[model samples]
Target chain A: MNDHSTPILASQGTPCLLVDEERMERNIARLRDRLRAAEVAFRPHLKTAKSWEVSRLLMTTPQGPATVSTLREAEELAAHGVKDITYAVGISPDKLTRVQKLRAGGIALTILLDSVEQALAVAKASDPKDPIPVLIELDCDGHRSGVKPQDATLLAAIAQALAPRARLEGVLTHAGESYEARGSEALSAAAEQERAAAVMAAETLRAKGWPCPVVSVGSTPTAFSAQSYAGVTEVRAGVFVFFDLVQAGIGICTQDDIALSVLTTVIGHQREKGWTIVDAGWTALSCDRGTATQNVDQGYGLVCDLEGRPITNLIVTIVNQEHGIVAARQGTPRSDQEFPIGTRLRILPSHACATATQHDRYHVIGAGQSDVTAVWPRFTGW
Target chain B: MNDHSTPILASQGTPCLLVDEERMERNIARLRDRLRAAEVAFRPHLKTAKSWEVSRLLMTTPQGPATVSTLREAEELAAHGVKDITYAVGISPDKLTRVQKLRAGGIALTILLDSVEQALAVAKASDPKDPIPVLIELDCDGHRSGVKPQDATLLAAIAQALAPRARLEGVLTHAGESYEARGSEALSAAAEQERAAAVMAAETLRAKGWPCPVVSVGSTPTAFSAQSYAGVTEVRAGVFVFFDLVQAGIGICTQDDIALSVLTTVIGHQREKGWTIVDAGWTALSCDRGTATQNVDQGYGLVCDLEGRPITNLIVTIVNQEHGIVAARQGTPRSDQEFPIGTRLRILPSHACATATQHDRYHVIGAGQSDVTAVWPRFTGW
Candidate 1:
């Protein structure tokens, strides 16, 4: 942002991703400290900050105890020397070869499943000497894919199907519904429900004589608001690595805690309408309107100065593929002189996970420093 | 899809992009024939399918007379032997160096701008011996950036500012508002308005002694619905290469005309809730709900079979980071046996440009063939 030999954002070009390392480290520490106090293992989901530099910082060790949404992330992390990972998404038969390859490459990778069909597929794919680790996903508040926590019959059947061929690691449940919970009490209740559901499912598997060792429960909101981890062994949460407007809207993190933003340059303006057009549209900031249903809708994103300070009442109201129209939140006409052409601005995203996927690298602005000190690369795809 | 020894899709992986070559070629022909009959030169926008293979098919020749939204696209096209390109987005001062570099590399990359500020920047950056070509943008409808078509004073000022230093190529206008025009009559009216605005701006510059030779006007909706391209010299439209649900909803194309889709594999199901979860979520399919306001709100996207046939009333109702919940439009409970785990499916996108941005490569199915014949790589970022 300031002079070294050159201006940081100016040299990098507009409409690019920026990571405030200071804020990101703080976010990482906050979660680490919280989980440590709760006595639960913290396996940060690497889907948000897909960069190896960021992943290395988030993991408990260089060998990891990390969570990934895809096998691609697991492979990339493994290349960076991360040995332990959990592919948290429910397993499908097609991805097992990649899982087997990762395991063959000396990485301890685990897969998740809910149905007996998936259990049998994992069993078929596993080698008896190095049986693939499996987790039975439990439904926490019925938000998404998972076997209902009370479905003891399905749990026992899946566990029995994995016997001798695949190691039944434990049960994992995500408090995805926790994202919709409002206020502290509601968030706390959602967290408790997630914790209880995972414990109950693990107990269900254990009652049937399966060694269900892990009880995993998480979602950014629940991870921060949970009253207790109780019987949970580990927690997995993404988005928190780069808390976004959606998180701020959900009371999971404050606006100042957000570490990621899209740097842009104002290119044109419609004076009468008070709309300042910037070069960072959906292609740069992503088309996630996650805050639209929140108590206060942050349309597209909140506009900020080059220093990443939010401009009061300013947000991106509309976006084309390569252009964003920024206007006052109240729709009041603003003088074109305020955001003249070539003025540099940054936009905080509506959803970090969605927005981060738009770019392949992050220009890291060092902690308390203006200059960009590092560039961390990221990857996408299965 | 059936002939390959190793099953094309089975080997590639799920949540990948698929381009039906037959459908895409038809889409391209439909637009080309329409613009040709209208007597306007087609300069297809390459922002939707940012692949060299697709660009080669869209361009008039390998040395193209093409349109691009970003300089990155321009450079990529140039690398693929495309010589003539119009960077359709409003240019900023920071990008001037790149424009100079592209020109130095023997690529004729023209830039767009609308104000005296931008004109001065261009003139300053331009070498008098090899002047930078500039196009003054005119606002067809109060949709996005550009100077008002009737703003004669500003138009004259910008033209004067570019005199002798920069080449004022002509005027360009995009009927972005056409995306909201519901009926055929409304779309045709929007096209007329766009042509009128561009022609008016070109005439305005010409009256002031500027040689405004080119008058470019287009938008996907207007490009196909235009009853007349009377004063427009060239037509520029993206997304027509792979018409999406939004285009179909607008009555510009039918659902069968959509050529892009996300291939996914069902991973889990909630039978009682009627949810069949797949591995393609917002990350793979994009979070563009462009059809939400249409007559038929195609929730995330219209669910399709592996062969590209839309399953009756089925759509991706909800999406997480790496999970999409497919369900019937009527919300009736479905049996888990209907979409058993591991079942392969394809989902048509709500917006092709947004959806295409999520992946790096397109697995192309040859014309009238089920087998994936090629993998065209794509690049992203500024």
Candidate 2:
């Protein structure tokens, strides 16, 4: 299905998501190789790519399982023969029916639980004959959802609640705080903190006579920065497959490493203001200003040429629902002659996950080629 | 097809869009009645709703033409028998083929052009037997794309280039700056500026012996704030159909007038920080912080009860891709007990256009009723 040819802009519509297949493969290989070297299982998070084609490339095994943010993704991935899927988000009672359906379909879908209430709910809903597997979410850095590893009483209570109807499979944690890490030192510390927390939670359960086999920990930033994964059995990270500006700004990846971009056409120009209006806007690129807090703020995204090369300091300064205003950064010359009306440009997003969700499909282009090799469909919604 | 019933949260997925049909109808009726009283055509922009059902409700004449942001929308609306449609975004050369196809299908699709280059391109590609119709885009506020109203040379050149092949239908302008209006006085002035600019462009065309019949002027703020239409024929506004927090902050609509919201379920809580995490996040509510600069900054969105009544001072403060953090505004009681896990809440979005674009379908509930009356599908992408 992967066909390579010369770049053809007219065939693909403007403001569509384009993925550099070669760069994407390199990214996958980097992570896959790193995890293999570290003797850790790589469970790629499907929330970022959300494409069956991309998932197939990421999987080491034919029917390998992955982590998904929503039941919709789990159902879609499972239908495509992905077994042992993990619904990473804390399972709400209302979604249990869908979970039951997926589990009954011969898919070993693992649910995440942080509270005793959630554990009891899962236990009540699970079939005793076919007990459900669950991973206890531990909060390492307190950035988002998860229980604290030190809360033994709460952890033991949750594990006991799931005794017969459900199994406490292991412990998992995400160092979302790793996103705030400044440099290599901070990033490594955050990674170690995440690893330690998950291992601590697993050990806590094991000490209580629970068979906690899994110790999963990850975050794109921490996963790449971690020096060791001694006690961690597996690591999960999504955005690494298509690094964005936020990742670049954090010194994790370079702008050239970004595999995804929004292909846009220059519609008009605001000459005096030094703004080149493009068809790609917030709706196309997404309203993710993740780089705003970073050392360098790319208003919306970094502007690049048709060949996916960054156009020096030009960046999208403003965006409406359907219009993006590209301008040169301060001290950079406004190269109006370089980009006139009808010029097609690529914009590297600040957050790959947010930008990718805006489009229904990705136009895959091989490296050194322009023609779309494959059109990968991505499904959205809860 | 509208059915009414009891409020059942479990059947519908969490973080799904919920449209209050009665509120939407009232909003539509108010705008329609206003435009009718003023003796002007009401061509509602379908960019916000993007639903055939909503477009059907907005049209005064059944299967009537409407304004759209993309060719995809025009195709969808045209397929549903909406004949005279206008693709509001500036026409690109690559999209001209699709425009021709839509025109060939018996749909009078009007294109928007602001440059002589574009006019010449359209003219060159046009079928002499059936020329494409275009509206000269006029810059009223310089907030986005358009040729300045006083740029007579450019306007005349475009008209001359479009002569034998493509016909210049009229002139249109949007007062996007009206979004920055502080109060009634500022809003009216912005509206007047939009009216004068569009009329001036139309007059400029007529003076050059060009037949400029249509003079369109609008924006949600200007459409409601304008005192007179004078030389304008039709008004185009979309978000007015589902007023949002940004509209309310601009004093254009009240919170009660917001017809669209994200129905989310509470998944967990951070009691010490007074944060209630919900399933609705940027993917559900959108990453639009439009009201951040407004007088009242409604974080991500205003939180409401299941019946769509705003819970005083509660708002969504932070959001990840799939998790929204709802918190009480300063000085308001932390009421953690009020919103426990599994509790359903409705969140009013900052921008209806941005938020609605995230969902595939909207679960609609009639006013004063809890049960979803219908499920309306909305299409996105260009």
Candidate 3:
């Protein structure tokens, strides 16, 4: 951890995002391998690593069966020749125009909805020649948006509403509550609940003489913990590409598996308060205290050495816009001798997706080396 | 509050940032008038609205006496012909090259430092012919960074380090802790402490026969609440250009004064749970739960109507990466009839600075009108 001679990061600006490519590829491969072994299609969510360069690695093919949170991501991926994509968030009427545009451009873009109102809107927007493929989102664990799996009336109503104008491609559900799962047992249970909910909905649609070809169910924790995909055609997970403290806390990935880190310099110090102020604050690191609810709360982010190894007991305790106060986790004394002014350090993020979006580009550290291999551009906004 | 006929926002995509120009102008004028009446120079921090268009309105002149947190802000403002800028964050050694580059390009760019290590780095990086004008940062309260006003030895040491190579321009301090102040009395006390610390530090340097010309002190709360600026050469404040919920909670600005909002579309609803899901989740509306500690926690943000009026008792309670769960505060029942699918709602930010950085562009509602007159682009990163 004391070996701070990172030539690539040393030359770069103090507050910048660094992606360990070796670790990133390993993380991506781990999830891909798991899903491949499970004999299910892996539709990797591009929301985490919003780079085409990263997306190319995550996708099974250039023309993807990918998942996206935003239409911007769908558009960007489509531009990169990704043809098959699922717009994962609930479809709003206003957003359907962009979805239709993407679909018209020969991208097999899919939209998700859980209500009859949304179904009717999708039906209204669809072309007679090429009806829009839709997914009925099911609420697995009362997490967020979705129709209940057992709501047969609502399920039949939504499918019937979409009948002639739109195509009911499948049913999808996300186990967002799986983030709260502590152990493998809890995670497995959450995954099963998600899978069962998704499959049940798909069955209901099929039983009612409706097309429900795809059964998608996932979340980073649940995807890894799922004992079986069962009837699910494809599995989707976003944060698995760059596992963070939240996923690490969920016991999915360890701190070492976290590919993203903010490269920062020790700007100044408050020796009396044992605070080593760094140039990277909430602006660079993001205000995601995802680990606060976990067993070991990583204040803002866990502090690491330049080589991307954790500095024992050190974390970002406080943050202003551009100033992060790095201190020992348990009020232990830290000194200038350990982290003096101009000392380069890396901070492992609390939430990878949140932190990754803060930066425009990623300085990718070469496979198993300290040298920066390449810089990948990231885009944001709706 | 019920008027939802906004042609501009309706045509535009959901989850875009909207800046009320009339309210913004008023917010900016309030601070400018206050500082001007106090007979002190105002160096408005361009960190809040990082747009050249916005900066032009905030600046007193084309060649600005502006404040910036990052070198990127300084560089961008410089490109817009801003000459006099103070980079307020503590200078890191690696960042000095860029600082020097800016100074060499005819920018009277001032860098701040609180330690001898930084002063030495500044001194080393300084061109003996045109030394970097440096400010010795003083910690007014036990806030973030700075040399303590009472720590004369360290102050003298820093000044001594900059003696021949770097020019000691002045002293600066920001009462970042002022945001924690509740009422006018507490705000005034925080302001006085910030002013006293800067003046006291300037006096200490002067007593040692060192030139300390520019004694700058301010924070949004302190800038407005400070009764006197007797010894201070200039006052610097950001976040006043677009007041937020946090500022409202601090009693510095009323909720009516806030200018920034996130325009989101109601995508779906969890009716039984009284949750209205919106497209603007943490990704669009930042993961900044800044109002959580306030007396009345505004969750993610306070929900407003399309015409930028607050909806009674509504707040965004939970957020996923791309979905926000807006519910009535205190778990009051909110039906789909109240907020149907495709209903465009504007969310007032919890922290303007944090929320504004989440987007790249602002859809500006023209002065006292609903139409978006212009689109202002915002830049971010180190």
Q: Considering only the true interface residues, what is the Cα RMSD of candidate 1 after superposition?
A: 0.9
lDDT of 1 at A43: 92
Q: What is the DockQ score, from 0 to 1, of model 3?
A: 0.88
User: Tens digit of lDDT per residue, candidate 3, span A208-268?
Assistant: 9987999998899999999988899999998988899999999999888998999898898
For model 3, the superposed segments whose C-alpha errors exceed 4 Å read: A1-6, A331-337, B1-4, B331-337
DockQ, prediction 2: 0.72
lDDT of 1 by residue, A282-353 (tens): 999888999989987889999988878898888998988999999887545453448778888889999999
Worst 10 residues of 2 chain A by lDDT: A1-10
TM-score, prediction 3: 0.98
Q: By descending lDDT, how would the candidates be arranged?
A: 3, 2, 1
Q: How would the docking of model 3 be graded?
A: high
Listing candidates in order, what is each one's chain A TM-score? 0.96, 0.97, 0.97
lDDT by candidate, in order shown:
0.89, 0.89, 0.89
Each prediction's DockQ against the real complex: 0.86, 0.72, 0.88
Q: Which numbered prediction scores highest in TM-score against the true structure?
A: 3
What is candidate 3's lDDT per residue for B46-133, written digit by digit as tens? 9998999999999989899999999999999999899999999999888888999999899999999999988888898888999889
- RMSD to truth, every model: 2.0, 2.7, 1.6
